[model samples]
Every structure is written in structure tokens, then in C-alpha cells.
Target: MIGRWHGLVIDCPDPQALAGFYEKLLGMIRVQDEPGWVVIGDAPDRPGVALARVEAWQPPKWPDESSNMHFDVRVDDRETAGEKVLELGARRLEGGGETFDVYADPAGHPFCLVAW
Candidate 1:
């Protein structure tokens, strides 16, 4: 490969705040923080989640073919994890199966909570 995969960048209104959500959800640390850019992870070399500020950003129409990207995080219990995710500012969304549930972050970016 030419270059390594550094991180996944998410566009939102508040970069730091959105990054904070991923930090709390993934139990990661904020390695870099600035006005419109933030990266969450203890190790820069490893995969991280980055948030970039966007003006008047509109969230994607989830479950639609137009929706390009999303995250799938693992959890042991679907029921318990679903409850916790709601507390973490994730809202329930449509289109998921038995082993996985779809949720939207505070910025309305879609992600999946998978049972493992």
C-alpha cells in the first residue's frame, strides 16, 4: 500500500463535540484538538476517528443507497448496549437485523451496534 489508513473523518457542525462522542464511545483519547479538526485515539499510528467542522452540514439519508459510509461497533448485549448508546446521544434508526442495530450520532451520522 502507498500509505496507511490514518483515520475516518466525519463532518459535523462541532468538531470537538462530535469527536468527544466517539472518544467516550470507543474509550479513546483525544490525540489532536483544534477549532475545526479533532482526532480521537491514544495512538496516532492506529486507526482513529476524526471530526471536521462543516457549515450547515446536512446528515446523510441513512439506509439509502446514497448513504456512503458508517461504523459498526461491537457489543456483548444488544439490549444493554442499545440503552447505553441512547444515553450517549445516539438515536435509534431504522434498518437493521437481529445481530446489529442502527443508530445515529448527535450529528445524525449513522452507525451500527453489533452483537459479538
Candidate 2:
């Protein structure tokens, strides 16, 4: 059986941009960086975000199409993180108030900020 989740691979138009957003929002660091690929992690060992630079990346049709997957980023300050992600160019999608805030990255990849 699977013990734990290692990481999640995200398809985006810009890996660097998406990775950068996650890095700032989650306070994660780039554990690995290469052409066409980037990985971010909370610590030196635990992986969090794995990003791929796709040339033909097409964002999922929002509020209509079914998303194959999505991510939830738990944070201490939902408001702060939401503002921070917005400043980083992420678009607000759903959820708000004191509980959580959902946002879509620059490439339209959705993620959530949950109060920690």
C-alpha cells in the first residue's frame, strides 16, 4: 500500500512561474530545478509540488469541465496567503472568509489555502 504522498505533478505553461508561486505561498523551496521541470518542497526531503513546463498546456475549462486533480495548500494565515498569492498573479477562484481561499495559479492550476 502507499504509505504517503510524495508529491504532485502539475502541468502548466510556465513551470518556473507556477513553482515560484507555490514557493512563496507555501514557504517552500526549490528542491530541484531543471529545464522543463521544477520541484518544490517544504523541507529538504519532503516533496510538495512538481511542475512541468508544457508547450501545449491547456488550462481546464473552469466551472464547467471536470478537473483531473487539484491541490490544497494548508497555511497558517489564510488571508495573508490569499493576498500574497494574488500579488504573485494567482487568480481567486472559490472559498473565502476565515476558513479558506481557493486560487488558480498563473497557468490556471487550482489550489486552496486552508487555515492551519
Candidate 3:
């Protein structure tokens, strides 16, 4: 293999809040939390994500323009998962096909709940 995947890094206004949202959303544990940085993972050795705070962050309006990155979470039940995410402060985004539903996190990052 070329190299191991480390983790996804997300930029947001409040790293803690954004990380907390993902923690609840994905059941990922918070491994480390600093003032402007938050790390989350499923296990001690495995890779996860680091949420870093960025000043004057602007949320991308997906569909209007191409998103630099996006998350795709697989779920057994799409409708139920969508509802749960919506309850967790995700705004519904347009252009979700039959296989998946799109939403924007509290930080305005786009993510999808995939039934496939």
C-alpha cells in the first residue's frame, strides 16, 4: 500500500461543537479536545477525524457550487436516519437521489445518509 489514511479534517467556527455533533451523529468517541481542536475516533489505533476551528468561516452552499468535501454515512433506514439527523440540527439539502438523503450539519457542512 502507498500509505495509510490518517483522518478527515474539518474546519469550523467552533471545533468542539462541530466535533460534538459528529460524535453524537456517528457514535465516534472524543479522543482529544483542546480549545480550537477536537479529535474523534472509533478506536485507539484507528484513524478518525480532527475538527479545527477557523476564523470567519463561511459555510458552503452546496448545489449552488461544488463542495470541496462531503461525508457519506451509511444507514439501514434512510428515513429514520434522516429524521434523527434533522433533529440533531441538520438542514435538509436538495438533490438526494433514491439511494441517499443529503443534509447540512450545524456548521453548514454537507453530508449524506446513504441507504445503499
CA lDDT of each prediction against the hidden true structure:
0.87, 0.81, 0.91
Best by TM-score: 3
Cα lDDT tens digits, model 1, 1-116, are 79988888899999988887888788899988899999998787778888999999999877674448888989888888889889988999998898899999999998899995
Q: Candidate 2 residues 1-116, lDDT tens each?
A: 86888888998888887888878877789989988999999775885789998899988766576567877788877878778888999898854556677778889877778885
**Order of models, best TM-score first:** 3, 1, 2
Q: By lDDT, who's the top model here? A: 3
TM-score of 1: 0.92
**Backbone clash total, candidate 2:** 0
Q: Indicate whether candidate 2 or candidate 3 has the larger lDDT.
A: 3
RMSD of each: 1.4, 2.4, 1.1
lDDT of 2 at 44: 54
As a TM-score, model 2 comes out at 0.81
Per-residue lDDT, model 1, residue 35, is 90
Error of 1 at 74 (Å): 0.5
Per-prediction TM-score to the true structure, in the order listed? 0.92, 0.81, 0.94
Q: After superposition, how far is residue 59 of candidate 2 from its true place, in Å?
A: 1.0
- Model 3 gets an lDDT of 0.91
